[model samples]
Target chain A: MNSAISVRHLTKDFRIGIRGLKLRAVDDLSLEIPRGQVYGLLGPNGCGKSTTLKVVLGLVSATAGEISILGEPSATSAARRRTGFLPEAPYFHKFLTGRELVRYCAQLSGVAASDLDAAVEDALGLAAMKEAAGRPIGTYSKGMLQRIGFAQAVVHDPELIILDEPTAGVDPVGSASIGRMIHAMRDKGKTVVLCSHLLGQVEQVCDRVAIMDRGKLVLEGAVEDVLSRRDRHVMTIEAMTPAARTAAEAALEAHGAKITSVTHPRRSLEDLFRELVTGSRDA
Target chain B: MKDSLRRTLWISRVTFLEAVRQRFFAFLLVLSAAMVLSSVSLRVFDFGHGELKFIADFGFGGMFFFGSVLAVVMTAQLFFSEIDNKTALTLLAKPLSRPEFLLGKFFGAWAVLGVFVLVLASLQGVVLWAREQELIAAAEQAGRIPTTFSIVGLCQLVLLQWLRLGVVIAIVLAISSLARTFLFTVVVGSLAVVAGQLQWIAQDAFLRPTDSPAYAAFLWISTRLIPNLQQFNLADALVLGSSAVEEGALIAVCLSGLAYLVAYLTLGSLIFRQREI
Candidate 1:
């Protein structure tokens, strides 16, 4: 019933060189990701998104503040057991097949022997990696690697999954696939925290977004709440003659409202691309 | 406790698999095997020393050198590969503790070195046995007593060598936990091995009287800090029975090796827990 993750007043500083100069990586960061929603953490490189995730996962020690995962202390094994993480540019052992890698992670995540097979299979299927699961990881393309990474992270069925740069270096088709996977996670009542620099993809897949810059949160809101223009309005008309258009403009003018420039509704280029090239997977 | 151990074992299993697949392990195994096998033909040039002593020295030297190299270089490589390749990022994010990860790496590398020493020791044993039979026949023909070797002593030596190398692996793991690069770990680890091999000199100086208390204290700390790797070089006494080595002394050496091994691994786990993966 608690928030999926609760972070407050968090700060992280990294020491540099022999002189021990302190570099602040995450500054007064606070986030409250709701349960069972797809939340996007958007930031440029070196903007502290990855560092915050690492601190949340207990991979790095924080310099100050507090964080919790699923109502438990962030760094505890119990917290980690309920959370899953897929790192940026995920690199697995080249020698292991995709299936082997997922199974290995499942065991490490404490998946029971009785449920291990079904868990692995279900995860692989969700990531669309089941067909390529038998191949060595070294032979995988970049998209397949990310897909396999997804499978491994979700194999244990953790309540919360943190993904850093999950769609980096992936083609748009593959990126869309990951977007759908994120949607699927949300549909399953799993809290999904995603960090990516792709704004268009974030706009499509994320329910809420927080943008970061220079170790600081620049903005946070629901996608529609943040993007919608309340002051402007548009109405699409069809089969209107010049007389009808003039009459409509006069009616608006009589009400002390001016008619702005209007254009035909157009689909986004991404939509066009997806429509034309429907089944071309970046496998 | 059982679950924790199982997690540690799982990590160790993967570590061992990764280590064995490396070309460096295969290369060293072949090179060490060749040295053991070549000890026979090279025995002709023993320079008036007893044949078995020369063979034992050659084979033991190969084990010592290559085993140390494997421990220092291979352990450091295994640790750094995980860190540099970002595989540690994926792994440490799991429910596994940092100590479990470090111990898993130690055991895995130690297991690889175990196989390396076992192979070289068995080959050396075969070479020693075949030469001993030939010498027995020749001595029977000439009515001259032949110098005999002990297989039991050889087995004991193998165990000692494995313990020594395990200590070396632990030292390298401790260094790797703090090091930022593979080269740094290897250079420092190799230097540590060399210093350990010469640690006996500091122990000797500590025993003698010194005018400066400061110097004496330095020697005392130095003697205790670095392990006396030279203490385990009992090839002559163990294999050829050139001198007596008491069972108590052997047990003492094993215990000393174990103490250092545990100390270094514990220290490594502590340092690794603070490391940002």
Candidate 2:
């Protein structure tokens, strides 16, 4: 099967102001996003990650090159029908209950009428928003908003899902919940393209990652391939007294090797926060 | 075709729900109802016209003025709010076409206007009927003829006003598609309404044998592009049976309004398709 998404030499130039000055947002960017894995598109603010996603999803027209989603030409209704998108900082009508909004999106996405109830309930459950589905969106907190947005995106059971800044402004507990939802999607054989600045979460959940800077692709590789340092080695030994440490250093010296700095492996603050504040509610 | 219509209806359904919940809609409904009810108390000042005619005219004037404001400002606000808030980014990213989105907005706004017009017209009708009954009793007792109104004519006028506002909403949507600010679309849309009200002048000039071809061509285009909003302003003649309206004339006016509505909506959709989210 082909990759979930494919972009070749894609470029985007936006005309700004009354004079129509060209502003290059994405420049000659190419990437092949594989299927059924959690992939992260990461960059600093205004680095064109969102722009690239928009172009792939057909929200913004590309200035040059070609792109496709699920082996079909991008921007066609067929392609979009199999794809789902949740934009950054999603805003829905305040008058609608959470279930109503998700049901509305499901109908727009062409979900079958007979299966709509099951689809909506399943999606809400996945996002852990089932308990609050009947409340009007105006009363939702930031975490609840993101959860509802997730439910809406997945309600139609699309093959591929693109989430931009899903964890923005969300607390650690909320962010962890989202990470779990992404994992659930991946386990279900659905391709998930995540765009976020939360590097720790990205490192933990993403199987492959692409980093962009200044409208250009700076790095793309499997997480293990890119993160592993082959030139260095580490050895952790328990009950090593001073004499044993000296012997280890002496053996390395005899073999023309040197002992560098030693440090213990430590978990990240995010992991620690998730551990300590595991039961905290967004309310 | 079925899918497209379904999508448009979904958009319209949501848009209608959003619009009806606005404080602005409620505020205007109340204000217009007040105008209709107060017309009964102010019937003595009749301006030499019959009491029922004066009351109907006052109510129709309120509906026209407030309805225009709602059509121009509220429609622009609704369209731009999606863009400004980035909700369009989510909806348009779906399989929904730009035209579907535009048409949805049109129907939604039109539906709201339909409600507005129906409520005020019904209230005005009741007020007129009550006053007509009293006047008929007085006239019968004094051996004079009683003034009356036509319910069918009032319904026809309501349909015409709704179509007129639909045209206005379409024009404003086209402007909103191209405009960068909500205020700009409202200003230009209001100006367009004013120009459309005066479009009959251009139509008259075009009919005359002018020496300047360029001026004639300009007036010709203006007359065709700007709908003659005055044609829909037959409230007194239609509602009070003051004058006879030709069958073909009513159909022609309706067809013209529909043409303008479709043309502007197409133009707006084309422009919106190229816009970057």
Candidate 3:
């Protein structure tokens, strides 16, 4: 199958002020995001990662180069019909209930009338927003807002989903819920592109990642390939006495190997928090 | 086509809901309604005009002034709110086209104006009818013909005013598409409304023979570009039967309103298509 998204030599320059000075937002960036995997696009603020996504999704026009989604021109409605997007810090009509907003979006996304009910319910179920779907969005907490935004994006059952800062300003528990939703999208064979600053969550969930800096791609590879150090190794030895440790090191030295350092394995703070607050939910 | 229409309607539905819920709409509606209701008490200063005509003038003035304000300010507010709040980001990312979004907003704001016209016209009609009955009784007792107003004419006026507001909304949308801020759109849109109201000056100058080709060319462009809003302000003639307006003329005005409405909306959408969301 074709890549879920193909961006070739995409550059974007925004004109600033009446003098028309050009400010380059993204410069000659190319990417091929594959299908059926969770991919993370990571960068600090103003690094053009968001601009690149916006260009791919056709929200902003590219200054030069080409882009396609599933073999179709990225800006065409046909391409957009098969894709979904949740913008960063999403804001919705405050008067609409969560269900109403989702249904409205589903219709706009071209969901067939016969399947709309099932599609809406399935989306709400996936986002864990079913209980609060009937309440007005003004009453929702930050987590509930993000979850409902996720539900709306997925309501039409698009093949590819792009979420920009889906967990920004959300607490850890809420962030974990979003992580689960991303996993669920991947499980259903949907391509997921996540843009976020939370590196720990990106490392945990992304199958592949591409890091951008100064409007250029600095690194792109499989998560394991990029994160693992090949020249160095660590082995965990449990319940070894001091004499045994000394014998093991001497034996390794004879084989031209040496133990560099020894320390107890530690769990990450996120893992510890999740473990201690097992039942806490943002809802 | 049907699917696109449905999508536009869905957008308009939500926009209408959002706009109607605003305290701004209610506040203006109440203020306009008060003006229309208070016209009955102000009939003493008729200035030599008929009593019903005086009342009708007061009521129409209220509708016109308040309706224009609503059209200019409210439409810009609605469009910019979506952009500033990033709600347009979500909606525009869908399969919905830029033209569809603009049309949806047009219809939504137009619908709110429809309600505004209806409520105020109904109140004005009631006040006129009540005063007419009293006048008719006294005139019959004095053996003179009682001056009256036409219900059908009032209805036509309502439709015309609604169309005028629709034109204003479309104009504002076009401005908002190119504008960077709400204040800019409103300022330019209000100026456009004023220009449209005075567009007949160019039309008159164009009618007179002129040797200056540059002046004629400027007038030609002005006449063609700025819609003549004065054509729709026949409330006194239409409502009070002060003069006879030909059917062909009314049709021409309606057609002109629709042409400008479609033209401005299309221009707005084209500009908006290039906007970086």
Candidate 4:
């Protein structure tokens, strides 16, 4: 279908304590994630973002609603066959090497025996884990673990990939690497639904964004449409003195324009960090 | 169907590998092996029984006790490690079903117990054979009938023990499906094993006419629901030839074990299908 994932007014509630108190985790959320785009689901902890994803993936049952993946019911294996998932803070068997883990996932995902090796190699190569694939998972750093987790998720070449907090504990370089991977998946005509607290990375990578707050969808739209103000404007000028700034403000006001504020452009700290550590990695 | 089976096989393969690498399995295997070896030295305390019989009983005791511990503790640990680590989230989000996942776990734990039984049974056989030869020579000198053990019976007992442990693993898995924590599963699984051992009491009480209907109903359900684990203790009859076990009776015991195993696995799968992850 045109929509890779469709959630229709989904709600999820959890019971807590011996008293059976109801805790609503997701409240009547509806979404239509378009195919072949990078979509971001963002929220603070306990805002029901993860719960929504879990319900969509059929890891948890919805309290009330309907969800479908690739035109099939969300809970069915037929739907999951076309979807891949990378859980937050992923943990793997420490005894298995990165290669073995990927291969095992491929087997579970039903990769044909003839294509298993090639599929595994391609996924590892995409995650930049081929070099360290032979090392046991226990020896992997947090960044390496995320990368290998990415490798396993995409090993079967699923049409839709859902990644939850893919860069939670990684350095800026690793985070950037994951951002690039999201971009590559989008380039390959695959639908990617990403959930992360890293708003900067989400803005950089997502074509569409949905924000959840307190178990409710507060905002959902294209990144540019939701984030940009049509009335606002910005310009960068080189080598301007105090007199030049006064003249520029006068010139703008004469044309029915007013500059709200003036300030020097500054590089984001993440950009500076990546620039400083471009050649070094925890891998 | 083939694809599902393939997925189950892969899961079980990983589960088996994870279990074998654990220090707990290694420690128990070594301890059981030591108990079997030390039985020869402790034969003087056999309390007037034949030396071969004492060795057999000691080794069988180690197998029964340690095998149950492994079946209960190790099975729960393996299942929980996946849940607590969130590996289940990664695996379950694929095209795999809940029943396939649980069955994979059952086979994996059962395989490890298979190794445990095989190793101990082989060692017991070696010890029995060596002692049998010694007794034969002593009997020739004193003109007495020598006590001997049956090799075929040892093999049969080994199979029965494996099946018994398989039943325990299934029961633990069924408990783990509903348990919120590993500790709960292990505690309840241990209690189930104990009940299975004493299940014959329920069976005996049910066979005799009882006046109380509630008591009879309870006994009736208990006898059917809990396996007669005591029935699998055929080592004395099978290995030492102390009594002749009819082939039909052995078959009946095996069928009973298989029935319990299937019933528990089916129950576990049903409960797990509704579990939240």
Highest lDDT among the candidates is held by which one?
A: 4
Candidate with better lDDT, 3 vs 4: 4
Candidate 3, after superposition: displacement of residue A257 in Å? Answer: 1.6
Error of 3 at A200 (Å): 0.6
Candidate 1 A-chain TM? 0.95
Consecutive 10-residue window with the lowest summed lDDT within model 2 chain B: B86-95
lDDT (Cα, tens digit) per residue for candidate 4, span B71-133: 999999999999999999999999999999999999999999999999999999999999899
Best candidate per TM-score, number? 4
Candidate 4 wrong stretches, greater than 4 Å: none
| lDDT comparing candidate 1 with the true structure | 0.93
Scoring each candidate complex against the real one, what DockQ results? 0.83, 0.85, 0.91, 0.92
For candidate 2, the per-residue lDDT at A58 reads 92
Per-residue lDDT tens digits for candidate 2, residues A1-283, read 5699999999999988889999999999999999998999999999999999999989889999899999899989889989888899999888899999999999999988999999999999999998899999999999999999999999999999999999999999998889999999999999999999989889989999999998999999999999999988888888878899899999999999999876667887877887888567675
Top DockQ: which candidate number?
A: 4
**Global fold similarity of model 3 (TM-score):** 0.98
Q: Is candidate 1 or candidate 3 better by DockQ?
A: 3
Give one digit per residue, the lDDT tens place, for model 2 in B85-161. 88888888788988899899989999999999999999999999999999999999999999999999999999999
Docking class of 2: high
**C-alpha RMSD by candidate, in order:** 1.5, 1.3, 1.1, 0.8
Residue B188 lDDT in candidate 3: 96
